[model samples]
Target: MNNPIPPRAKKIPHTLEIHNHVRIDDYFWLNDRENPEVIDYLNQENAYYKAMTAHTESFQKDLFAEMKSRIKEDDSSVPYFYNGYYYITRFEAGKDYPIYARKKGSLEAAEELLFDCNEMAKGHSYFQMSGLSVSEDNQWISFGIDTVSRRQYVIQIKNLVTGEILPYKIENTTAGGTWSADGMYLFYCRKDDKTLRADTIYRHEIGTDPSQDVKVYYEKDDTFDVSVYKSKSKKYIMITSESTLTSEYQYVLASEPTAPFTVFQKRTRELEYSVSHYGNHFYIVTNKDGATNFKLMKTEEGKTEKEYWVDVLPHREEVLLEGIDIFKDFLVVSERSEGLNKIRIMRWDGSVDYYLPFTSETYMAYTTTNLDFDTTILRYAYQSLTTPASVIDFDMITQERIVLKEQEVLGGKFDKNNYIEERIWATARDGVQVPISLVYHKNCKKDGTNPLLQYAYGSYGVNIEPYFSTTRLSLLDRGFIYAIAHIRGGEDLGRKWYEDGKMLKKMNTFTDFIDCSRFLIEEKYTSPVHLYAEGGSAGGLLMGAVINMNPELYYGVIAQVPFVDVVTTMLDDTIPLTTGEYDEWGNPNEKEYYDYMLAYSPYDNVKAQNYPNLYISTGLHDSQVQYWEPAKWLAKLRDLKTDTNFLFLDTNMDAGHGGASGRFEALKEVAKEFAFLFDLEKIKS
Candidate 1:
């Protein structure tokens, strides 16, 4: 590779004043997506990215091909029985989209095609199909389609028997719809035009014009977003409105679609709960009554108010009750404790209780589709860093387990025994222990000579599971260690873990990742020269903060769709996900929060100092973190940073928050990032 010139953004001074504090933004002009100048600057960055990495073009193609080769081009998912039909999703030999089909009773029955996304997406540059629901009579199917990739979907109906596309369509929706028992009406949530927030619930009659659909309910608060769905039992249609700190629900019988929704409970600040129905009562999982770790309660069907609630599973100090799945004669509770997930099973009569056994110390297991309430066999999914994802059906009665399907790694030399997975703890600055999950080839040593890649996303109480990835074989086979930092701000260790890393304590997330990185180097797993970091979205925020604070600790960093311009974006309520995020990141209108946000915001704090090599990515139509955020951040980084180390930006002009929609196409993006890291390490195939 040769020395190359980087793109420099023009400086236009823009002053922002709030609470008598003034800040200057030189690259603020880059935020206007409609401006021709902004588009030109982004294109120039893309060109520079290409020019700088032109030497590795062939290597990248090889990387892409290697990664794609692991995938089964024509593979089908395990069919699950739902509503008297067994549904399956499979990809064809040469298609980028999936074909959703179903069989009436058994696999021997004639297959019925519900949707072929490849046919529907023919003319669109960017496409996504979701929210597929079949009517009760099984004669009609309603689904949502998005062409622009901004997440705003249009609901379309089709007659399965006649194989004809209907004229009924609903626009600006959440890409989901629930059908009534009679299949005469569809209930869906509509998004606000400007904010793109799901704010209204509407009922659309099957053969009627969508313009005449009745508005069933509306959520007026900008802080709360709404969604509508039918319960698993198919008995009730529920409309729920939730915010970061609170939630409320309204329900109506599925038999009477036109009935007014009845409030389950009035909304209260700091109160959160979700309801599930089984038999004659409603089960509630909630944080009400100061249950920080959450608890389960029950109330009679007709008397579902706070006063009538009775404790079912009382709150435990160290255990976090994440969710509950109810069946006719049993209950499966998902709980987290000691930084690991556990599934608890109990009989309906409360006569017996036990937990499913798992052998792996660091792995992820979660409940899968169990639509029927009559089955004794519970279906779930499990995976580890060294194991491919597998679907298991466990019988609660006999404790027998069956492996329904394990993801096929097509080029078939893959073996679980060739790798090792371990869990280690890293002590934070405040003496808190954070868990780190790592995996490496059996041939790889714990010597400081090897390169390692660390990843984390410690925000929004989202726990980063050490799930298996076939694409990661490219790194492990080349002597690279892959690790996941289970830092704070995530619910890995319980709800308290998340509480300590958000709001004013958000800095803990950044420091936690850095501490884990240092721990790895100290343990002789890898040294600073060979240590690489990768994070996306909120985790991308982690990457930005760590790079600003300890640039010398990493050899290179990859931040995808980073939310770097935090203060500026949070202050603007017009953007999607901003207003509703006030609780997660405090409302900047307050003086205390405004000052605190400014101190850590990556864009506001980027200084004139030496920085690590960076490869950043974003999607032009991203609805979560706008592409301009990364674009402007890169512009400023190129202008102010003193280091001449490689800095590149790649923007997908046609995609949204999720890079590419196609299964094989998304692997290309991963190949590009891996190629960047490999090039920095001078590793060639």
Candidate 2:
């Protein structure tokens, strides 16, 4: 952790390949182990806030409290029965605890549920895998819990009428389960991951035989993706995943768990599917023409009933649709326009359209909907630069909107009101347009000299949109500009966009990010020397690419639990997330594939160059990406790089890819990141 980063003019050394067993004892993994002087410096920072001056935890508590009040009086909602209560972990006394709140009829009784995570974990430790559902008649309640390993689970069905609980313990991975229409069939998908390659879908006749002796017709295979959807008494299972891209379809009839599954018929390589059933028909949306726009097709008895189009915009990139929400005859469709970055809702017959304005001012959004026959409640929550996120609830029928919550900053200290969301397009060396979303305080002198932190993740068909964040408010409020570089390897532009950024075209994602950084400098948003970049996991690759390609252009780099040794990880089958990702990253076993991967693989491409301030982090218990990749790479950088901005290794001993065990812990990590950036850049004020 003491080695200084090497300058771009110095020669870079090749990383040594070693059979290092990655586990808990690595030196980089530790908590609260900062330099004594640094600890003293941090304690002095407590004059403002205790947890850390980098994060305003006090402000956050006040914000959540205010948000709770806002959730009240926001009456617009969807018709279907939904559990209005959600439980979250709270830190009280000396232990982590669980709290819940229930939304009673027309009144949200937001009271803390008297439950503790420690107590819950004592009996049912796998609360993360727990499931909750109340029967349609509100007479029966069913819930399931998992035991860490052994793929074991216990399903408990309680009779509210008699207050009797019948629990069954089974050892198998339950992909999903639902109650049948007549409440007779308890349909669930169970797979023996220890012995079998593919999981089978099953129908258990509750109160009859245990889960082992269940019925599975035409047993589902492992090659395709299968998902079970539940809506009241309706039970529908969709199985896709046959082709490289799986499109979902509705399952009408039950299949035998003992037999093999039938091959899907109407599947095309160019198309993907998602299904929903209502009114004796299954609504199907297909992207056969392109990954952007979709054609809506409704089918009956596994046959097409009528085919039509929704959100029919110009190209695939312009029109992005979710599904056909059917309510009696009227249908609701949601559309996401890529170019404009706005969400719009329309009817099944393509009539009565309304746009749910996209909040371009935030970092990202987590959207959810609660609906029924007549009413629909849409909830969108996000975070931005100046403004901490506040949820907004929209009533579809009356079109009435309510601000569910806003962070009530203590003493009115933080306000992002003057923040602006500017969409700037940067052209890659190849002339491809890479969009960068920026959120920064308005009155912050535009001398193009402020510190700019550009973050990006260009892999795994994931999309990073603009959403609100209260924790990040600490940074933006501190005279920093927050931005997200929407490059490649994300669904922001659909499947083709992802396809172009992965495998052989992997370099495109890196170049696109580089272009974004360069464009920011050209636009006078910030000076090239003050520019900072970051990426994690897939995005971590982006960080490495930018740092190595033009280290001098950036002031610092934060690569968290990165996959730098791509060629090695892709070849080793023992690592998780590799075999399945072969489609995304080429096979290193093949000579051609190995050569292609090595071209951009950080380790292989390392050479003498001026580098930026680098901070590398990893977790020991990462089940997805191996921690060894970064551990070994950092060791090489120590022996190779030839300059002076500290090269730190902050590896977590007991964490995973998420980097923390609790919610606040994650915020602590964010604080450390901000501290590192602020320290390296020597930011004023």
Q: What CA root-mean-square deviation does each model show from the true structure? A: 1.0, 7.7
Off by over 4 Å in 1: none
TM-score of 2: 0.76
| Span of ten consecutive residues with least summed lDDT in model 1 | 1-10
lDDT of 1 by residue, 396-457 (tens): 89999999999888787898999999999999999999999999999987888789999999
TM-score of each: 0.99, 0.76
Model 1 TM-score, 2 decimals: 0.99
Clashing pairs in 1: none
Q: Write the per-residue lDDT of candidate 2 for residues 328-351, one digit (tens) a residue.
A: 424555554553344455554665
